[model samples]
Target: MKRLIATFVTAFLTCAAPVTAAELGDDGLHKTDWMRDTFKDLPEDLAEANAEGKRLLLIMEQRGCIYCDKMHAEVFPDPKVRQAIEENYFVVQLNLHGDIEITDFDGETLSEKAAARKWGILFTPTMIFLPEEVPEGATAAQAAVATMPGAFGKGTTFDLLTWVAEQRYLTDPEEDFQRYHARMIVERNNGNTE
Candidate 1:
């Protein structure tokens, strides 16, 4: 009778251990409210950025792309990055495989993913920088100022953010990136050694 009781107790603990582990993982992985809010259409907060006279940053992503998931879960959630993006650019999120209608400045209606493809975006998580006033009837070739594709971590993302915000890409593509990035880090640190 004593052996049977011990055996049953061990079995019960083994079953409960997996359940507890699963619950812990679900808590962290399922809490995705930040990513949820940025999906489908451009967030209404973009109007605030527009009012501040900032250019638009259109992010194109696909559901299956691990890089896109990482970007949403890690980089975009950082407070500093989020604040900079919100203040400096009108952000639009487009699903690369979905069929949502978006009207271009030229008054043409195209599916969201189709528009991305028209702009020569061939990779997931492509970020396209657009000037404030895209000309009416302008083709995709004319509307984009710059394009960045693939996953980028917080540091690189911040560098790219400053580069585009400062319009450094126009002066010298090769040299400006390093200079602009260094200046941005200094400005961010403000003489503090971190």
Candidate 2:
């Protein structure tokens, strides 16, 4: 009975503790086990994400952006946030100034920087959440269900990801992201966070 109680305590603590994160890559990006290293093709990545039962997430960041640093160091390291991303999303990182080739959902191929410009991504640490079924000839930015610009606190970030994963944007279009996040904040303060 003592051992059983100890096991229960351990399990609870493990579940309650914040998750540690992976090391930063040489590219100055946090490298998680869940991030995919692909050819930067949106359609192919979408197909792969679908096959893995995950949503395709495109995250843009620069090498020296402090907001990116904050996200990798603070927000993403939270266990609940990390778990939500790892379990429900296949992330692909894009360097804001990189010259690497990227194929867009609309079949346009361009460098990472060019794509960023085309997509009107003017901020570092922008997270673009794509819908499962993108219409033909739509650009990735055009097909995105939601876009998170700049770094946010852990709670907001987690709630945004959760909203996207649950497809709340589609079903609760009237609620919107702001309303959902506002409700989440209230719920958290009320002790039902999650």
TM-score on alpha carbons, each prediction: 0.64, 0.86
Error of 2 at 165 (Å): 0.4
lDDT tens digits, residues 68-185, model 2? 8788878987999989999999999998899989999999999999999999999999999998899999999999999999999999999999999999988988999999999989
Give the CA lDDT, 0 to 100, for residue 137 in model 2: 98
Cα RMSD to the true fold for all candidates: 8.5, 7.1
Please report, in order, the local distance difference test score of every candidate based on alpha carbons.
0.65, 0.91
In angstroms, the error of model 2 at 166 is 0.5
TM-score for predicted model 1 compared with the true structure = 0.64
